[model samples]
Target: MNDTVPPPEVIYVDTHKVACNGGGGALGHPLVYIELGAEGTAECGYCDRKFVHKDHAHEYHDPSPRPEGEH
Candidate 1:
């Protein structure tokens, strides 16, 4: 069986700046603020969650549904 883990979740935003807390609550990680690069993309250091600018979000095809309350 393949042991590789699937990629972390991806979230799209309209702005270059965003904050992540691994979804908050008991399962959450520490809060972190990230700024997307000129390419309009960034990844959370703690959770590895990808943040993509809305304009570029379409470039990636994420079959998974977005989490509730995420942009």
Candidate 2:
């Protein structure tokens, strides 16, 4: 039995900071704000949704690691 779970939903944002409400109306969790900080990536604690900055989108896709501040 090799059941694989899919990755969490990803959202591309223009800013480094964002707020998430789960997007499920009454079923959604409380609104929480996240800061991407230096890494340029943040994930929602309530929904595990990944928020990636548009400028750092390449880091999320490319597995190879490169120099920092290059992206």
TM-score of each: 0.70, 0.72
Whole-model lDDT values for every prediction: 0.83, 0.79
> Which stretch of 10 consecutive residues in model 1 shows the poorest summed lDDT?
57-66
User: How many collisions per candidate?
Assistant: 0, 0
lDDT for model 1, please: 0.83
lDDT of 2 by residue, 1-71 (tens): 74744336778899988999999688799989999978788878889877889998877864333578653
State the TM-score for model 1. Answer: 0.70
Model 1 pairs in collision: none
Misplaced by over 4 Å in model 2 are: 1-6, 62-71
CA RMSD for every model? 4.5, 8.2
Candidate 1 C-alpha lDDT tens digits along 1-71: 76754448877799999999999999889988999998888888888888889998767665566778864
